[model samples]
Target: MVTFFEASLDKISVHHVGNQSQDELYALSEAPLELKDDVIPGLLMQYFLKPFEKSNEVYHLMHSSDDLALNEVHHFATMAFEDESKFHEASEQIAKHLYKVSTHPNIKGGELYVAYFNRVQIEGNPLDAIGIFKSENKETYLKVYPDKGGFVVDYEQEAININKLDKGVLIFNIEKENGYKVVVLDKTTGGQDAAVYWKDEFLQLKVRNDSFNRTNNTMGIYKNFVTQKLDDEFEMSKADKIDLLNRSMKYFKEKETFDLDEFAEEVISNPEAITSFKNFKNQYEEEFGYPIGDSFEISDNAVKKQARVYKSVLKLDKNFHIYIHGDNKLIEKGFDDDKSMNYYKVYFKEEA
Candidate 1:
């Protein structure tokens, strides 16, 4: 969804943000960092842009109130976008907000880099972006220098690794009225409790209703319906459920677009089951407040990701696990009266 091959770091402001609960002080820089060296800017670009290369979900800034101006990150980023002179001032506000939200006991104080980027390609359009990054963890590096012929090893010092980006968000310059398009990465988010500061507290965001999210939501809701809800209203075997799952995935892989009616007829097949699925889907939207569209363009990336979590195995009383991929009818389950035991008969033409 995003590419940074042509991206460059134009300028950046550096600040030190600390954990608020620990009573640590946040230091603000008076001016933006000077990128005088030619190579330093390129290296900085790699550190900031590499992780976003394959980011699929796009987000937009959000606020609890009706007004978008109240959102701290959105306000500052918009100010900086409108006038480059306000960039440093906006960075200060961003850092201050981060410091205020860093209330978790395990949160670490780190250097905050607020940078202006150029030519970040997203969905094929090259747009300017604003990047807010934090470096939390540091590694000890051994320095070695040559005195004469042999190399002399020096002491170790803590330094941030260029390959690791702790927390970051890229806000594209497009869509000002609807809150800018945003993508975030938080590698150091310890747990669900500490994760809110980066995404929810500092930069309030909501998932965009694009193809990727739509596909993801559709797949998720269907999986829940099949695995959890379907058993309540209908009778099904484990093999039958696995076959249904496989068939749905096969349909997603073969088609470019998804239609509710088509999926219901082709995948669920039974009219009674289709009616139950439709009711469950409607209830899901009302319950979660996440609307799943009946028809949308399918995202291949979402399908690939969903495939990893789909269960396709049938566990039979810890004795044998039946792996069903296709044609569940080929496997038959029956009872034996002589030994009073359950048995399964499998059909095959060739053995692998």
Candidate 2:
């Protein structure tokens, strides 16, 4: 694995200020003595000489001692002093060479990926050059021209809406126009702060301090809905009330054949009977193809009997409204309180 220190040094040397110093300039009046401690020579050694010296194969390939190679290095240094424009161009060329050699297909077990420039806008003529190189693991290296404005990269292509430096993790959102995609990244421990690079601007997304807690709360509600359990203690932890309401509706639909008054009485009086009634209802449905009609009466012998009684039949109401004989208190509780005597109110259509 190439360490960060090696990568940083390579980046610096590529820009070609590896050995030049601001404090002193080499005097042209130097006598033709042994030039052992030359600054430019030291810089050349630091950038290129040392690497080739360590590897004899590379040294021979580059022909380091050749008169042509020495002239090329000297010519590059002279241009750096005489022409600022040529200096920048030479620096860029060196940087490109260094990058090409040092950046392998896989660095530190991660692939190197590049984002090519689809279009460019220059003052006079556009240089259709490719843009920055990025590691598959989110390491970034960019080359920019000082003369032209810097390049702009839109994360829209990556499906990322926002990028945030939260502590040491690169947090981002991968969202579309109205849909949400997931954001995932590796976490670093006690390292340099992570960088968040968006499309030349700060990303627009809120970073929550307790993102884990929020995520847990959301997942809890989802679990509750799946389990059909209501967690009323925590407000946000509760699933949609509609889920519970739907379960209640299903319960009523299955048990609707039972006399409501008897069910209310059994629920309040002998709650165990409610369990038996439920089991019986399940068995009855399994045996019989259709659900039994409402208004079956529980006889004195505990046998079920169909009632033939008729009253003023009402039209079908939107809400579930079943009439069962019960006292005022039971009626006041809307039959929720089970102090009611069981009676059946049957509705039969009159023959036309």
Candidate 3:
């Protein structure tokens, strides 16, 4: 049935060509003739008919039709193409290439590596796919599939092992020079001002003043005086004295010292007290080096109370800087009363 249908169509085309004039034949050579009806004799004459017998125009028409048919076939094949199948096939070929590359003896067992795709537009459409893998030696290979868009090539460093279940996944072998060692730092808790210092192979923390307060609330003793005024007499009632003593004790127990510079700024604004208060202030300076703030209260029924909170400082060697992750938390009771906590695991990477 198919052969008969094709033969009938062919016969109609030939009859149409047999009846055409020389001018019509030339026009048909420039463009394809649109068949408007299925009348066998009409189309054959329009396409195949010619003024001269055994004209070369007949050959040109046949060639033109053949070229058109070939183009249509190619278009249909490409339109029916499946990207998933191409991806699977490309992945298999990449696996084979990786396997060949891994057999070399110089490859390392746990180094991370990547593969890049250099081809574009396969089978008439854009071929943006990549294949990622790990090299156990220069011969053993493991594939890594990213759950994102983009061709599968161009894997690098941490991205190479992001999908691996085992930490021991082979990153690369010693034979390949494309892989480099990577250092990943911990991004858990702490503020950006918090830094790490290396001492005897151990990573120590050197927190900033604000970050220190966020992690340690001991300075709450003097954070209550931002809005209150104190009397000149320095005398306190029984209850006020008790409150002062309790706060003082808590401050000393928590910080063991106070910041005197911060204290003098908030209290004793009189220049005359410089001589006498100098000695008392120096005592705190000797311990904490600086004062963050002072707390004072006004009272109608009794004497007012006051106290001071000091700032903290940390010193470290030159090889390290502070690195805080995006998800850290800062706790604060009041001004100068703050603490930082590491709720998640902290990671440290060696600086190269």
Top TM-score prediction, candidate number: 1
Residue 112 error for model 3, in Å? 24
> Candidate 2 lDDT, tens digit per residue, 1-352?
0011121111111121111122221112111113355563334223321221111000011113333233322233334334534544444443333233332222222111111111122212222212212222332444444444666543323221113211111111112221111121222222322222211011212222122322222222323332332233223211123323233233333452435444435332335533443444445445633243334422211111111211112223454444333221222212323655333234444643
The lDDT values for all models are 0.91, 0.26, 0.26
Model 1: lDDT to the true structure? 0.91
Instruction: Between candidates 2 and 3, name the one with more favorable lDDT.
Output: 2
lDDT of 1 at 226: 93
Each model's TM-score?
0.92, 0.15, 0.15
lDDT of each residue in 93-128, candidate 3, tens digit only: 323332333322332233222221222222122222
**Of candidates 3 and 1, the better by TM-score:** 1
Ranking by TM-score: 1, 3, 2
Cα deviation at 122, candidate 1, in Å, is 1.0
- Clashes (backbone N, CA, C under 3 Å), per candidate, total 0, 0, 52
Q: In candidate 1, which residue pairs clash?
A: none
Per-residue lDDT of 257-347 in model 1, one digit per residue for the tens?
A: 9999999999999999999989989998899677878999999999998999999988889789888898988999789999999888999
TM-score of 3: 0.15
Clash pairs, candidate 2, are none
